[model samples]
Target: MELAISIIVGFMILGAIYAIHARDILSAVIAGGIVGYSLVICFLLLKAPDLAIVQIVVETITLIIMVAVVLDSSRVEAYGKFDRPAWVTAGTAVLILAILFWFLKEASAPLAPFGENSMRMADAYVNGAVEKTGSINLVTGVVFDFRGYDTLGEATVLVTAVLGVLTILRIKGKR
Candidate 1:
């Protein structure tokens, strides 16, 4: 499982690098989509099914919108010359990598062992959600009663994104 996760992380890093270094806007957008999907896979591997589902849906919508935008825009490749020395950039990147490695080493402890439910919040919700929220379905009670605002915020963001895409498409049609 660890090896699989490592391979996924490697692919994600490769996707990010491809996105950043891609000469064509369409290629970069596709690479970015790959990275986003890789993140969804990572969430699933971590046993967060809800997060994985949300990420997959959001990523799909975002990728579609981005592809539309890319198709509508000019495809000029702009390469900016770096002012800083290559060694300086390399050193900075290495330092950042080292910091990330150290942080991951220290903070990589699992919140709970694999397949174990050890979260206090989970326990609380499982035990009290029905009683407090008066809902027979604990998941529904927790989502609608306990975290309704958070869900609303997510819905609002999705609606806003759709509106933005519609507005952009309308402007493009006018041209």
Candidate 2:
């Protein structure tokens, strides 16, 4: 799993660099979207499905809006030279990302194997969720009752992202 994540991170870095160095706005946006969607895969690999779901939703919306805006605009920019300082900055970013990845790997070293549940809370949720939450569905109870605020937070993030994009796309005179 770690190996897979490392490979994905490599691609993620490449995508970000391509996004930065891309000459055209549309290509840059597409490359940026690659970086984002790659993150969703990383989240899933790390056993964080909730985070992956939210990330994919937000990334898809962002990618669509950016592509539409780039296509709609008539702006053109001359290709810019990649100076030594810019290269240094990119290198620094890569170093930071690498360090973070190392930290993530170390953090997960003690965790149980993939597909195994090591969480103490899982036992509690499974045993008493139905009676306590008054929900016939265990999944529903866990999401809405035991972890209500977390679920709300995820929903809020999705809604806020959508609304922000809509606001930016809306016409000045339109409500």
Candidate 3:
């Protein structure tokens, strides 16, 4: 399971890199979707079904919005030009790689093994959720009652992103 998760994470990183470096806008958008789907898989592997579902839905909507934007744009694809010198770019990449490697190495040591459910917060939520929020479903209660503001903020952000994308596409249509 750990190996599977590691492979998925590797693919996620690859997708992110591809999205950033892709010459074509359409390819970049597709790569971004790949990264988002990979995250959903990661959430499932971590035993968070609710998070996985939410991620899948968000990813699907994001992909649709991005594709709509791309299709409505005048250019089918656009390539970005790097103005920095090759050596400077290479040095920056190397530095970033080194920092990432160090951080991964330090963070890879697991605090708890898989299937371990010893968290105090989990116990508290499981025990008190129903009484506190008057909801039979603990997850739903926690999300809607305990952390309702956070959920609302997330929804707001999603709506803002969709509106921004629609505004850009609409402005492009005028031109």
lDDT of each: 0.86, 0.87, 0.86
Please, what are the lDDT tens digits per residue for candidate 1 over residues 38-141?
99988899877878988999999989988998999976688887899999999999999999999988786866655576777877778766669998867578
For model 1, the run of ten residues with the poorest summed lDDT: 108-117
Q: How many clashes (backbone N, Cα, C below 3 Å) per candidate?
A: 0, 0, 0
TM-score order of candidates, best first? 3, 1, 2
**For candidate 3, lDDT tens digit of each residue in 66-141?**
8898887853455567899889999999999999999988896655666675577887778767779998877899
TM-score of each: 0.67, 0.55, 0.68
145, model 3: CA deviation in Å?
2.6
On TM-score, who's better, 2 or 3? Answer: 3
lDDT of 3: 0.86
Best by TM-score: 3
Relative to the true structure, candidate 1 reaches a TM of 0.67
